[model samples]
Target chain A: MSRIVLRNLVKSYPGGDRRATDEISLEVADGEFVVLVGPSGCGKTTLLRMVAGLETPDSGSVHIGDTDVTSLSARDRRVSMVFQSYAIFPHMKVRQNIGFGLMMRKVPRPEIDRRVADAAAMLDLSDYLDRFPSQLSGGQRQRVAVARAIVVDAGVLLMDEPLSNLDALLRLQFRAELKRIVHQIGTTTLYVTHDQAEAMSLGDRVAVMRDGRVAQIGGPLEVYDSPADRFVGSFLGAPPMNFFPALVSDGPALSVGALSIPAPSSLARFAGRTVLVGVRAEKLAVSTDAADGFLPATVEVVEPTGASVLLTVRLGDHELKVQAPPTFDTRPEASVWLRADPSTMRFYDPETSLALTV
Target chain B: MRRFALQVFCVAISLFMAAPIYLITLAAFSSRESLNEFPLPLVPTDPSTETLSGFLSSTGVIAGGVNSLMVGLNTVVLALLIGLPAGYAVARYAFRGRQPYQLFLLLTRALPIVVLSVPLARIFLTTGLYDTTYAVTLLHTALALPTTVLITAAVFVAVSPEQEEAAQIFGASPVQAFVRIVMPQALPGIAAAAVFTFVMSWNEVLGAAILTLNQRTLPAQVLSTLSFSPLAYRFAGGFALVVPALLFIAIMRKYLLNMWGTTLK
Candidate 1:
């Protein structure tokens, strides 16, 4: 029944001119999983630390369930944290590490042992209960960290880039495992990571932070499909959404160089002004046929990533990336036709960078 | 061929280092008559317990041994008690003048012990603590504290702060986090620091000699009385002085290994 609420949390380091976390406010429902994702130094980690009571906000309050835990120490806050480095006690065996929280609370030895065993079994670590952290592989150590956090049964769990240290294959495998485990435990989790893919896959809701403030927060598909601004649109997707400076004509047609394409009717009000037309790489369809509406371009680079082929194309002075199906064959230096779907195209005001909605 | 040459060179250096200790051991166990015969014996011709037994029985030697042991143990306890927390503070927390404080500790070491010893002796006399093991231990702790702080700080720094934070998040208070997570990880280095402090106190002569009269440490007693003692007694006294230092290292060898080997992951 733990619901987390942050109210205008602002934290700034002494030496830095910029605030580490600036006026961030959000609410997480009971047993909700929310991920804060951004580039490094974007304060996602800072925001999560504030919630865990590891970092104090200069001005604001943090509430967990019904308690205002802003002034409480991390121990009194009743939260469990998983660090990026795992932070497993190297001197202790897996069993002792998992039971450390319960031990700290003066739980009975038998009960501690039972809970440790339960957590170890859940993480598939029962066989290695006697082993030290140094003896385990990277993935196993991460699981041990998770087991340690969950064994405490704290309502709120904070994870800071937990999968960042693992190799790619292991990261993918553990990403699923972590999501499944958190879901099963039903803890209100606030996870911070710089990886957008991890955010999308693991979080029930994704919060995109930039420069110490949350730029956008919504469901993953909602964010990906309708990003709030240019930064959110550009930061969330792979290869990023392409932005082109275009002028909206009387017919609300976007004119890029000598190429013209019909803009969505919603953009008609913004006619006769320069706007940034945003299109996802996957939204741009590449075809060999030079149809009436298709813009002709030369393929500059062809990259095949097993399932999809990414093509870097030159349209006049602009280079646009397009993601096509793996079967689409186009060698570098070949001429191709690019078609933009008007419905998927987003319009942004160049000055404010905010998306323009009808 | 290069590797073989390097190995031979290393062995040669080791033997050179061990030569003095070997000579002392030889003379310590040699009969008094054998030691008196010129051209000091390369090896003990007649190895006997006579010289060691005689040295041990001499006036003040046994008492001095007890005083030295007391001083060394007390010095280590005092130095670590003060130094460990200071070291952890410097390592983990950021404060104004921290760098200057560390530098000041180093600066205290650069000053000759004789400079401090005279004033310290005067104060000890005034305080009615003169000629006691306590006076020697206090001076030795002052000498060892700088090293203790630096070593323990380095050790604590090697233990990741994230681990302590993780511990706190798991319901441990700050002190509990330090005791449970950081302290165990830092034990090896702290043990190494303790050994160093013990050896420093054991081998210290000038401060011990200046600070005490009747309750003189082994080194102070040996140095003060060495001029009149026989060569056999001198060698035996020197050998006796070396024993505790060697034993301290031996006991802490596992921690020393840990300091050099495995990094805390």
Candidate 2:
């Protein structure tokens, strides 16, 4: 039931060479699911570990509700974490592992039993209570790890890539199950992962990180549609947004490769500056003739997915991917025209990779 | 043709290793009059029970064996008590001077023991620890410590830190997490360390010879009495040495694979 806040937290290892977390500041509202997403080695996991008190921050403070727990040991933090490997005690039975936390606090034997049984039933681990972790399958071990955490009933839960070890099908299944469990408990949760889809589907709000800094923080769709910068746009989408190097023009059109694409009226001020155009694959329509916002492209390859066909086209030196319906026919070396609606195309400052207006 | 020769060469070397031990056992089982004959009797005409019974009946031989057992068990317990915590700290923590601590352990094993023997003898005499079974046990701890630390540290390293952290998050304190979560996983390693330490202490001759006189350990007793004592006593003592080492190796066979694997790494 506590809201957690981290202010200007910094964690650097000895020799000052590796900064595991650098100036990270975040807040999680009570009962909210806040996901921290980034590439590997991007410090998202480091930030979460600091919050759990597994790592000490070199600077700034971590506040759980009104208490500043910056210098507290992990045992004193009253926080639970689910590790990527699950880390269930291989020797102990599921019930003993689940009740370990209670036993440590010296809770009465009967009380520990009651709570452990309750947690097992909640996690659907009741049937496997007597089994050792080695005896269980990967998915069962994951549930036992969750059950161990739930038995503690900590106010906040920190999950570090908890589903990363599961197979794709299991990951999806557990992602939904985890959401339901977290929602049912209504505990404040901070989950860290490198997977964009995991962040999008599970997080109530997502914080996209790059180079140990949060690039953008917003609802999944908000960050996907209206990225704070070009990095966020490129990182969030699958098949990635296509980039075309273009020069700003005085009229309603800009020359890109060998074709002109419609420029929004707002770009009239920057006539000579170089700009990059972002066209999402699904937004680009392939046809025979040039249309209002069309650019001609020479098809390099047509890759078929069951649902959609992606046409990789050569536009001067740059390659652009155009998504078309599965029925669309275009062979290699074929000349095809692709168009994006003017409102859907994103613009970026080529020099800085920062998003530009219109 | 070359591979067949190499295999035969290895088998011949093994037999060379085994021949003297086999000859000694056969000679000890023979009677004193039969043993007097060199190059051995193909089958002793007068193999008798007198020599085996006489060796077993000797007070020094029996006392030395008992003392060796005590010293070995004591060394194992003492080494593990100190080594487990030191190993865990060295493996898991990143406090200042950690590299220096590791270097110090490596230095302990690197130096020749002969150089330390006289100085250690002087120190033990001043401390009133000379000529006692406990003194030999204490001396064996120094010999066992470095191996214990290295082996146990490797064991702890293999037990992931993330698991301990996960235990802490589940509400166990650092100490509790180590006891409940970490210890169970590293038990096989600790057992292996104990067995190694016991065998090292049991096999030691130099330290035991320098430390004790009346309560001499088995190897020290055997070495001192080797030329003077009857062949039967020497053979029985040798058998004792080989027997325990073989037993320990058998008991700790599983960890040998891991120990060698880790050593290779």
- The two-chain DockQ for each candidate, comma-separated, is 0.83, 0.70
**Per-residue C-alpha lDDT of model 1 across residues B64-102, encoded as one tens digit per residue:** 989988999999999999999988888888888898988
The residue-level lDDT of candidate 1 at A243 comes to: 83
Residue-level lDDT of model 2, residues B11-108, one tens digit each, is: 99989987776766666666776766776676556766666667768768788888999999999989998988888888877888888888788888
Clashing pairs in 2: none
TM-score of each: 0.96, 0.91
Residue A74 deviation, candidate 2, in Å? 1.4
Top candidate on lDDT is 1
Clashes of each: 0, 0
- lDDT (C-alpha) at residue B98 in model 1: 90
- lDDT score, candidate 2, position A117: 93
TM-score of chain B of each: 0.91, 0.86
Candidate 1 structure quality by residue, lDDT tens digits, A1-358: 5999999999999898999998999999999999999999999888998888889899999999999999999999889989999999999999999999999888999999999999999999999999999999999999999999999999899999999999999999988988899999999999999998999998899999999999999999888888889999889989888888899987878888888987888788888899988899999988987997788999999999998999999987778999999999889999999989899898888999998885
Q: Which candidate tops TM-score? A: 1
lDDT (tens digit, per residue) of candidate 2 on A75-116: 888888888888878888999888888888789999999999
